[model samples]
Target: MNKEHKIATSMYRKIAIDIAQSVADGKYVEGQKLFGRSVLASQYKVSPETIRKAVYILKDMGILDTEKGSGVEVISVSKAREFVNRYHEIESIHSAQSDIAHWAQKQTQEIADVIQKIQFIVDTAERFKNSSPLTPFEITITKESTVIGKSADELRFWHNTGGTIIAIKRNNDLIVSPGPYATFREGDIFYVIGNDQTYAAIKKLLFE
Candidate 1:
């Protein structure tokens, strides 16, 4: 549920476990009476109702004995130790569940970010396609390509392939309007704009 309510519930459970631990440790022997509810509440800096809840848990687990008029008493150190061990096991399970939930949330956010980036690329492509009759095509330069280390001007790129180079992508960097002086390199992606036959022509010119 909400954080505040969860915290309050945990506090009462923690108080119960602490009291049971004291009994198990022999700090309070069997048959030893505990402080009254009001005194315990004051000592623990909690409301009487919180103390009542803690005492109820201990009594239910056979770690404490209580009567309407008399104060609570330690009844079984063995049961008290058992209660503490059980609480720890349950706590470990809850911790694991929390870790799984956190990881799931982080993965969901990462997926959302990836989707946003893809959508942006799609929208930009649509706008570019609408701006001119010719759509842009991308081609990567490989080490064996004939165009390697050759500038667009030197290769007579536009005259040979009928495609105009608009940009070049080298690793993480984008060189917009890289012009006739931009030299081809292995691993560089060229963004070119041309007619339908331009793609085949560029490929034949670069590789054949």
Candidate 2:
């Protein structure tokens, strides 16, 4: 149940959607020739005819174009992948047909203006999630640093500044999750994780 039978009939279309998604994600750049039918079929565990059928769907969507002897090349891809994911959520045959039709219609519309808007939204969301610039950044312990030649406890880095040294790169090796007993050498670069304000305080404690 659960549309597996319909999946059998529409397997080629699903395969085409996957190929289109790869194009949209920049995995397969535009004008890049795809593998031959047999190779693609082997990769997807399908028959060569199935691959051919999928290529036809992509060609119809304008995501791919096939020349006489040359293989298919990607043309353009927008947020077309949403339709691929949406198709799996459809319950009825009518809904599935309607979804595919809508996807085809949108393929012909203008989407160059929307990609930048979508990218801006994505960037703004990331910025909102990561509001601090400190972000577990790294700093090398120079010879002029006050904290050099001092143990973590002797320096009382956490006492003066709330930053926690998560790791230290000494020589060519890495000391991970070091405790307070871990000594700081002149050349050891410490990777610390703390709030934005705490890292600023740590820098002041180290150099000044």
Candidate 3:
């Protein structure tokens, strides 16, 4: 949180708690009149506004009674103890909320960092693929392909597409150098290599 907010909140809350504790301890008994706002501010080394806020908290909790021109008076020792207990409970909840917010922010940052790293890796791989002539391109066999269920030898694969199949990925298995007799199956990922026009020829021969 902001430093100014911390000072404003903590100072007045501390003063209020101190006054309530005094009342609870019998240092200030019930029905006893305490100093005015300015005098209490001077005594506590705070501004009159701070004293007013502190007194307001006590009065709101029924621990103190305040009047405009008169003064502050202790109303109930039991209520003073209740106010202190309630303040501590609220402080505990605030501390837990702070901890949860801190961790959530940290996790969000870590997830962003991971996404950035993955994007960098993907961009680097794409650059390498585009720069290398030997890197094989991939195409998936679909139901529309005329070559589906046909063996490479029967379709005269290399003669038709002017490309060489390096591997066929079927399901979880990689069939490296699937020779002329290897039949094309739906969902097969063909890893092939050729000149620039080879991919277009393969697509035309298979789909058109």
Best by lDDT: 1
Task: Report lDDT (Cα) of residue 115, candidate 3.
Answer: 69
TM-score for candidate 3, please give it.
Answer: 0.49
Candidate 3 shows a clash count of: 0
Q: Using TM-score as the measure, which candidate wins?
A: 1
lDDT value, residue 139 of candidate 2: 81
Task: At residue 133, give the lDDT of candidate 2.
Answer: 48
Reference-based lDDT, residue 200, model 3: 91
Error of 1 at 78 (Å): 2.2
Residue pairs with colliding backbones in model 3 are none
Clashing pairs in 1: none
Residue-level lDDT of model 1, residues 62-167, one tens digit each, is 9999998988999999999998888889989999999999999998986776566546545655676898677678999998799798899998999998888877
Backbone N/Cα/C clashes per model: 0, 0, 0
Better of 2 and 3 by lDDT: 3
lDDT of each: 0.87, 0.75, 0.84
- The lDDT of model 3 is 0.84
